[model samples]
Target chain A: MVCIRFLKALQSVLDSRITVLYETHKGLGARFVDFAGWRMPVLYSGVVEEHMAVREACGIFDVSHMGEIEVSGPGAEAAVQYIASNDIERIVDGQCQYTLVCNDTGGVIDDTIVYRRSADNFLFCTNAINTDSVFCWLLEKLHGREGVEVIDRSGEYAQIAIQGPASLDIFKIAFGIDTEEIRPFRFIETTVAGSLAIVSKTGYTGEQGLEIYLAPASAPAAWDALMAAGAGHGIKPIGLGARDTLRLEMGYPLYGYEITEEFGPIEAGLKRFVALEKGGFIGQKAMVERAEGAPKSVLVGLRMEGSGVPRTGYELFSGDKAAGNVTSGTHSPALKYGVAMAYVAPEFKEPGTRLNMQIRKRSVECTVVAIPFYRREKK
Target chain B: MEFPEDLKYSKEHEWVRLEGDTAVIGITDYAQDSLGDVVYVELPAEGDAVTRGETFGVVESVKAVSDLYSPVSGSVVEMNDAVVDGPEAINEDPYTEAWMLKIELDNIEELEELLSADEYQQFIEEEK
Candidate 1:
């Protein structure tokens, strides 16, 4: 009896609200890790190999762990505009915008993509771990408001991202998408694998890519059709590990790593996403004050002059004085050197400023450079 | 996946080959496989001392960082500059070409504590 109970408990511990791609990962030499309570594949072959595959050709990502919240009602527009940092009024029907949900103190609560389904309906694509908190925050804020309805639809849907240089062609061949018409940051609903799905033109890679949102039950068929369609197109399945490096190479901010509750958009080099003139948003005044340009520190990119890959929380120095610390870093496969994104003092954020990072207790010289160490070519 | 018959292995996945007063050390194939593609490796300079079960160096993949521990106490006599410069070689041939260092042993008796090839294989099996 005790052994049976132990086995049952062990089964629960192992099973983590598995994604639709869970079975597919097992056949692909995937190594799994527990991330935010989800058993996520950290890699298939290796981080560098997968990184290069996406850079040279194309890559597919199972971003099903991301959450969704559907908001619709008479007062939905006012509620959304009051909640997010970006001006949702700017996004019309069939469009999406990357924005931040900030606290009253101008700190980032969560970063999300707002998909405008219609004038009064929007779906929020939230980070996996922050889904519950964002939903709760929304409910609490919209308590007295009568006309707006916010529903947490995170568990109902799954998401996928196809990224790289060859993404558009692969998407066209696989899904019959007419890429010549779809503008960036726009989305359209269509049938994929005999199921309803929302195909969007926004991506995190700084490359032209598309995001697909569909129901969980039909996600398997959709993924299978996609894999079969793109099998001969040099499309490799990417994992969270490579996804991290690819985004870091572009200096895109990861929520917990670069922008958190302790820092504002201005400090994380995302001021453009914040619409200061559009008042009535949460943290509007504090964001306006920050826009005055008196932030204590700013995000900057650092390339190691010496060897040694910098990791998160490593100390950074400018000459003899203590500077800042690395937030996210890796040995960039494309750049052929270690690249890091750090929040350093304003004086040390210049393009050519030389700094030092202590890797494994040894100080190594690094030079501050611009974000996006890699840029995709325009077609 | 290959564990040589003559080399002694540690639970931390380091393999050591004893030759007279000198000992050669590197990560086992199991270790290299688990670490994935190694992007960077940090090694102690020549003439530095290392103690048994202590961290002597670090190997970093694009995702994670792992400490390379010394299985036997010794003073480092030489370092593999090749693996330091291009760490992917360790993934290619962890036992031979990827050998991390050659140390002059301070206490050769420490070899008795290490597992034999068969025992190490069993240990890896048990871990799995």
Candidate 2:
């Protein structure tokens, strides 16, 4: 028994990948968690503290685990338009669009961001766990096609996100670049911290921020430079724990949780991102059928009225009937209450609808609320 | 992690301190540290009965949920409302201010099953 346990532990250690900033995170007193086969920092100071820093000040995240794929050649735009649910044609060069990739039956493969660098060059940022699968799916779909090339560029770059109200100022200070012209969803290829990087005005957290894609070897120096420049802006290193809560506060659908292969984008309340009018995509037919028919279930946000935090897989109830189940839930550090994203019967999707979540032996009351639970006021 | 020498420990990481016929129970420092930044806590009512080695409540952190096991069987006499209102107290001071419940002992003999402070320290070390 001991030998088996030892071997298992050894195997896990060998299998888990560490980011380039692993040593830096360790030095800053980070508590690590195994996320998608990567040993990532779950927290440095605390989840709540890091969460607040992003809301009020600034926070930097080592998101190097997120995968990057590049599609280039004359047929790049065609290849992307065929696979992505959103209309890539809508985004011009230097802009990006939040989109989804789906299978033949219209089930979501992954929620991704498609960046149009030029007419012949595009990039995809995919979820860490789904990176390899997404890469293969893109390759298989574009195989035998002329003038299109798909490459898995995930290992070549490390991604970092600096977010908050003060992000622009920090960016100017750290990289010596005037980001005043960089609108949301737009990016610029420039040198930062003595390395070539793609600085995109995008982030999962609903805050003003930039996600920088730079070479893996230059990540440590860039992280240090950002932190140093953000010192006066009250910047802190954020971890995955706060990252989940921050995105949850925005009511964003995480790939595995809200958007999954079993549920399409329509059921996940992301129909707007699916450009059904743009025909000939992989899942257009099924998605159009789903949009016209009554949905099996619809995603809604639940705010706890009573005590006890709702957790993933907990069943929701309306009266005595089982409504649905919680997909992702957490105590909102910003809201000071428990909030959750749940899939319930279509009849129970109204914002003010009341429901009960079965948490252990007790039923905790919650109210269906409009998502974007904590939206930032427009500056 | 500080393990009070006067208190007995359970294998599930609960600590018990006897005061006359009433026993005060809380999680140990090691347990609270393991559960970082507790966000919510649910405990039994004042009159509820708890059995030894059974879960009496739950402690939730941002990323995980953990059950609180009773080290000794008893009828709950009182619950620390402060800890319930602000669960971060458990992370701040698990031993004194975060004492979860005070219960009237159902079987004083259950204390014999618990470990000494030194034994618990050794146990956690071996667990790691």
Q: Largest DockQ belongs to which candidate?
A: 1
lDDT tens per residue, model 1, A1-379: 3464455446647776678879888888788887765888999978888888788888889999898998899899899999999999888999999999999989988999999998889999999877877887898888899789999887788888888778888878877877657999999999876678899998887777889998878887777766777788778888899999899899999999899998889899898899989968999998888878678888999999998888899999877898998999998988889999998989898999988898867889999999889987666
Report the C-alpha lDDT of model 2 over A126-240, residue by residue, as the tens digit: 9987787788788788889999999989999999999999988998998889887899999999998778999999998999999999998999999999999999989999999
**Candidate 1 chain A: 10-residue stretch with minimal lDDT:** A1-10
lDDT score, candidate 2, position A354: 95
Separate DockQ for every predicted complex: 0.82, 0.70
Q: In candidate 2, residue A294 scores what lDDT? A: 95
What CAPRI-style quality would you assign to candidate 1? Answer: high
Clashes of 2: 0
The alpha-carbon lDDT assigned to residue B66 of candidate 1 equals: 97
TM-score of B chain for each model? 0.97, 0.98
The C-alpha lDDT values of all candidates are: 0.88, 0.92
Please give, for residues B1-128, the per-residue lDDT of candidate 2 as tens digits: 79989999999999999999999999999998877779889999999999998999999988789999999998999999999998899998999999999999998999999999999999999997
